[model samples]
Target: MDFGANWKHYDQAIIPLPPDHPITARTLSGIPGPGTLRIGSSGWTRKEYTNTLYPKGVSTANQLTEYGRIFQCVELNATHYKIYSPAEVQKWVEKVKNKDFLFCPKYPQSISHHSSLLNATDETNAFLDGIRAFGNQLGPVFLQLGEQFSPARKATLFKYLESLPEDIDFFVEVRHADWYNNPTELREYFKTLREMCIGAVITDTPGRRDCLHMGLTTPDVFLRFVTKGNHPADLKRLLEWKPRLDAWTAAGLERIFFFLHVHEGEHEAAFYKEVKEVFGIATQETQMSLF
Candidate 1:
């Protein structure tokens, strides 16, 4: 169903807050310009952010339709840890039909956690079926393995991956220190993925405490920058990552999608302003005129 890397400017979109009349400057500071469209936010079914986009107290279908207007794509995190029905996923697809929006679904935790990796047969099948059901609108599916991986689990993981369809674009998120301990092993892993033509989900977290840091591995990178509040300092740090991303692009990487997540704004508006300015994206503002 034409599943391949398609670049969408995700960090450019604004997450409008309900009470704020004009979007706060700090929240949108990193955006490029007003005319650029974005596939934004990590989750679509969120009521706190999306409810304001739709009419009050409407059905889920109606709310999703209104929610779909602001962003072109959303990273699906819910299905990563939960078991959902195909019928439920189809209903969501119907709600946003005829739109350019795409869904990048995360792999279920059962398949990622080494403790339960052996019993992930049912969950993996369900997750794959859901993505396939979404058809053309489905973005690359991510297998975000948590930080506790071990060498013994690698064989099972490879076996399972071999069972999947080749056409589907799947990316892996390796957070464990074990994967990085040996250079030869890491190179082999990256080589295998390149041979398979599957991208790697590269992650970079805040240097601050309690965040994950797995640096750039390949050119086709998906960066997840964890933001805590309106730390003006975070902006400068992001620039440090640019050289790495630029290197990837120079090496003939076809596409990259940088997903930005801010958890520490006093409110969403405050966070939005800081994002645009830091990233050097364009900003939009309105002024009142009296004659």
Candidate 2:
């Protein structure tokens, strides 16, 4: 969210590119009909959500259970900081078992940012092993290449990506400016994803418009939407995504994991309430399918 913080320092305007051309399935393959759209926040334990999303005096230990009753999924960011024990993973899994919920964990920072995806076999193995405990409750496990990683270090990226187990789905978010600046490199980057059957994480933030490359390496789409506040500008930017998401859904895009990030202290409940309305995504009443 901090990456493209234009308004924080800018005479420059926060102009999102006009919508891209309609996204068609890259190949002949696709899901049978309109696919699922999973809408959620980056986390559910926000104090802002207390009493509004959570009960007025819900215990901290019971928050995740309450969170499962509302949102369809979560960006399980706690996993990004470190490898967790299997018992802890199972404890989380137990809380949401009644609902068709998913825990979309991220690559642990120890493996991803600290070791930078080199010779961290023990860490990688332990991380993957622990998350696999989610069993059927697992969503796509996403890996974000460090901002310092670039096309120059693609071999390391690919090696790690290719080594990932096929059973669990994955999406990759590349932050390097090089991946988006050059058309040829971008094409090759996506081509590799298609070959490997991994998806791409399309990010839309104010300062870093290039990260909003709307390409689909796989049918499933994971979107990271960062907004400034409840300002009209923020709503306008979110509205821009409606048509693009609509087109993809009509084209049978499999899943949409839309995570909204706004500066803390803003009314997040209001922000996402409006987002759900604008996107015409499911309301909590319609969440019987847990999507």
Candidate 3:
């Protein structure tokens, strides 16, 4: 959650940019089809969320169960730092088994950071094998390359991506400005991902506007929206997204995983509420258990 903490002080200086013209034009042209949209925060266990996101007296053990009652999905951030055993991932799967929930786990640092996605077959397999325990509840597994993972190493990166198991869904986030700044490279990169059936993550944060590159390489979208502690501009950004999302849905985008990043857990719920109200997207209702 503190990934973008350095930019916190610049909150007042951040101004929302106008919509990306190419994306807007495409959306308006209509790519007709039905789609599924899931909106939720990165994680739900923060103690600060007590009585707001979670019930006042809710125990740590029951947080995920309670979170499933409201949000349809969550981004599992803990996995990025440590690899979980299959049994451990299964425990999480059991917690939200009855609810219509999805868990989007991040790639472990051993593979993405430490090993740098090169010649780390054993670590990669171990991570994938463990997360496969989520079965049907598994969402996209995102590989967040470090800021130093530049375009120079793109061949190695693409090779690593091609090596990933095809059955599991995967998305990638590249922080290198080269990927966004160069028009030809950007188009080619997106085209390659589309052909491979992988996804590109579109990040929206104050410090980096270029990271908000609005391109859909696949039918699905993985949006990482970093908010400035419930600032009014956060609401404004979400409002702007409403039309863009509606257009994407109309144009046949299949799924959207919108993960909000806010230090205050309470702000997540507030943001989701605004998205629902403004976009007319319905919040998912939990299924009742027969037991």
lDDT of 2 by residue, 229-253 (tens): 5566777788777777777776667
Winner by TM-score:
2
Query: Tens-digit lDDT track for model 3 on 1-291?
Result: 555544556556455554553533333335665668787777868775678667789998999888887778888888998988899999998887455699999999989999898779988988998999988899999999998888888898889988988899999999988988897778777777777888889888877778888877777789988875567777777777777777788877778898878766656555556666665654443111101
The CA root-mean-square deviation of candidate 3, after full C-alpha superposition on the true structure, stands at 4.8
Candidate 3's C-alpha runs over 4 A off are: 2-31, 281-291
* Clash count (model 1, backbone only): 23
TM-scores of the models, in the order given: 0.70, 0.90, 0.88
Comparing 2 with 3 on TM-score, the higher-scoring candidate is 2
> What TM-score, to 2 decimals, does candidate 3 have?
0.88
Top of the candidates by lDDT: 2
Model 1 lDDT per residue over 1-291, tens place: 001111132233222211211111211223332222233457655555533434567675575566565556667887867756778778778887546777778777767774446766777777777778777877777777666664446676666667778877777777666665665556556556655656556444433211122322333446565554445444554556555444434444444555656563233334444444444452454111100
Q: List the residue pairs that clash in candidate 3.
A: 31-251
Q: For model 2, where is the 10-residue window of minimal lDDT?
A: 21-30
Which is better, 1 or 3, measured by TM-score? 3
